[model samples]
Target: MLVIQIYADNPLRNFNYLIACPSSREALVVDPLDVTRCLAAAKQHGLKITKILNTHEHWDHIDGNEEMRRHTGARLYAHNGAMGVIDHVDVGLYAGDTIAVGQSIKLKVLDTPGHTRSHVCLLANSAVPGLFCGDTLFNAGAGNCHNGGNVDDLYDTFSQQLAKLPDNTKIYPGHDYILTNLKFTLDREPGNRAAEDMLNMLLDHDPHNAYITTMAEERRINSFFRLDSPVIIDKLKSEDPDFSAAPSPRDVFTALRARRNTW
Candidate 1:
């Protein structure tokens, strides 16, 4: 059995995931920001953490790496691009690299550079498949491209790479920004029933309770993934007259990202 545990960390509402194979009792922690909480959770489950996987070099994601490693003595894995940024990476991962944990849990690495040039996401091919998306992708929005990030790169990461994932793939983002992101989507496409319904459902629960979402649900509500939709396109055009010049999907995405940075 595959055990996936999620913990919401402090200071930034960050999420850290512990994925373990019960048969072998070997586990990997994804984007651990709070070492104390993570170690405690692992001890509670009686799982030995064998590896620390980073999705990016952001402080919130890798802050607890050294401490976690000190406690568990787990090897660190990060993208090759994060060499200088991340202090210690035992294994420099790339786009096609696969990480095998225990006997059956295998995670495929995807180079999803947008939040940062070296950002990568881990796709777990387990009984319950999931995508550990860092800041590159979110529940209803994509990451900002202000810090060493490119809009075009983010566009491709979402449209070409992440969009190809199975509809049932569960998304585990770095932060719990779902409620705010969905609110922004509603503002952009008020006529969208999917966004409205999702917003209402989220309102019923605490913001912290609605962090995880499926790709299928994201497709229905995430405006970033629906750049080509007529409603979204029209909304963009209305917001910015420059967008009316026969903008491509990429252009629409670019405009939306810029607007979201301030929104």
Candidate 2:
């Protein structure tokens, strides 16, 4: 069996996940911001840290890499494209690379760029189907463009790569921004009953508990999934001057993300 544990950290409230394969007693840490917490958690769980899987090269996601790798002798796995940023990635993953964690446990790397040119998402069905989405995806929404983000690229990644995953897949994003992102989703899709109800529920409680969102839920409510929907495209055009003309899905997504980044 495979188990996942989450640790939230620092100013960004980044969410780090530790995945373990019980039979082999081996584990992988994903996007840890602090090595102290990751090491502590590993000790508590009685699992040997074997690998460090990076979803992207963002400082927050990779800051603990050097420390954790040195302390635990864990191999660092990252996109082959992030050569300079992430030093010594033992397993350089690509769009279709498959990584074996233990017996009956494997992660399928999907090169879901647009959040960054080298960004990728780790998909697996070890226990529950899961997606360790770094900056590429978030709770109720997706990542904002920071370094190499292109709206068009994000659209293709979301619609083609991520959308292809099974609806039951559990989406564990790099950060916990559900409440805030849910508000944005509500604004973008006011008529969505699920979005409205979820927003109401979030407004009444703390956002920390709303960290995890399912792929099934995202498909029903996330604006990015509604690529051909006139309401979504119209909203994107209204907010993004760059998308005033005939724009592709990527152009529209970029504009929306640009506006959100400034918010």
Candidate 3:
């Protein structure tokens, strides 16, 4: 699988992906907000985009869908639930559905609802696995439940589905929030040497190339992955006098999300 990740120069720092089969040059666009850039990328790579997929029904994610579809004549796709929210979906994807990109590449759709009820993540089952998680997951933080999302559902998505994926799976999140999220991790777990080191490294790293974190790397830097750490629990306790000392992982996750909303 060949991946061309384009960084949309908007206030949201959205990362649009153009994934193609190197052999066939048949491609698919993910959450394409910048239509011109996507078209230019396809032109540069000599790829034929056969499909356009939105991970959720957020306006920003689907803003350029109509134009892109008109430009490339690509079929539009989204979760079945997004039928009401997103327009002109040629295919409504389900949990186990595979989106075939050319002859060899197939992406398994995972029903990952938390960022929104319509959210779904696509797992490319290539030699080097890649998870194109829109707002469901981030570099060092998890999506908040303030906008049509549930904290419990987000936690379940992490523990039951995302956590089970191979540690080597490359995480391709929709936006660039690694820097702020890493600061949040340090704010919660000041003793995390791994997070600290990554923070220093990322100061020089381009945010455009920041979405290539593996599950193994996330385990060390992402606080959501380290919900059981004493330092994070202690920080929670210190901030909220009534915070539980022996908080469950889910409890820790809930508290962290709540705090991040205000932080």
lDDT for each of the candidates? 0.85, 0.78, 0.91
Error of 1 at 41 (Å): 1.0
In model 1, what lDDT does residue 217 have? 85
Give the number of the best model, judged by TM-score: 3
lDDT of 1 by residue, 1-263 (tens): 45454556465778888888878889999988878878888888888999999999988889899999999999999999997899889999998899988876899999998888999999987656799998988888889988789999999999889989888899888887888898889877778798888778777655345447889988988988887788778878887776666788889888889889999
Candidates sorted by TM-score, best first: 3, 1, 2
Q: Provide backbone clash counts, one per model.
A: 0, 3, 0
Model 3 agreement with the true structure over 76-96: per-residue lDDT tens digits: 999999998899999999999
Best candidate (score: lDDT): 3
Better of 1 and 3 by TM-score: 3
Query: Candidate 1: where is the Cα deviation over 4 Å?
Result: 1-5, 204-211
In TM-score terms, candidate 1 sits at 0.95
Give the better candidate number (2 or 3) by TM-score: 3
Worst 10 residues of 1 by lDDT: 1-10
